[model samples]
Target: MNENLTNAQNIANIVAQEVELMSALVQLLKKEEEVLVDNTPDKLETIVLEKNTLLTQIIALEKNRNSSLSQSGLSPDAEGMNLLFSQLSTSSDVQNNWERLLNLSSAAKENNRTNGILINRHMVRNQTTLNILQQNDQTASVYGADGQSRVNSNSGRGIIAG
Candidate 1:
């Protein structure tokens, strides 16, 4: 079981390093989101596209990870697969993959927030349209002033009446 224990220690170290890398990437992504908040819609599209590519890679790696762990059971304990995984454990590829995952997550969140902004804009526009139509219809009616839009007979200039 020494081999398993040793492999476990190495795996644990890899996991810890991966976590740290991912965390740093996450913080960077958050800063990027803030920077992109004021960006035009087209620029945000580029981020989303990049995020999607990263997401594809992250998903593939995640799928392979579990299989790797299970198969580590059968890999030669001191050579071959162990060396392969050991080298990869500290390699730039793993770090990059985690970094990409963080970027994708943050970009997805920013996209959702942007969608919310668009929805609110549409809702406000629709309401303004409705109010304008109502006023127009009221002004064009039989009694020139009968349906004149009622101004808030009460103070409505942002005064709290309650």
Candidate 2:
């Protein structure tokens, strides 16, 4: 099973990198939320494209994780990358899909509905995280370099911390 360990380790490494990338993208999305709440949509098209790419990366990671498990005879830990992937299965797909509904550019995508759902779910979770930070008066601590607090405000949506 050393080979399996090596393979699992390799896949785990890739999964970890992808997970980090997704986390950064999620942070970017949260920043976009802050921008949308306080600023104009001066370059929102770019945001949408970037958001789509993040979703693609997330889905790709999920597929890779599952494939690795099957190929390496390694049952993924229930709380490891599998758990991270599970978070994506939440409601963000709805929001992302809905966003596409308003964008003619995304109308041609077949998985628009699924993506809308995922994005919405993701935003909901992000908002919840911010809310917890706020309720505990930890906004400053969470918003490193004023990043957390500045981006906290969801413009009355109460989803953001600012």
Cα lDDT of all candidates, in order? 0.52, 0.55
Task: Put down candidate 2 lDDT per residue, 34-138, tens digits, no spaces.
Answer: 555554567667878887887787668667766766666545543443433333334244334323322432332424454455557768977888666666465
- Cα deviation of 93, candidate 2, in Å: 30
Strongest candidate by TM-score: 2
Query: What lDDT, from 0 to 1, does candidate 2 have?
Result: 0.55
Candidate 2, residue 71: lDDT: 66
lDDT of 1: 0.52
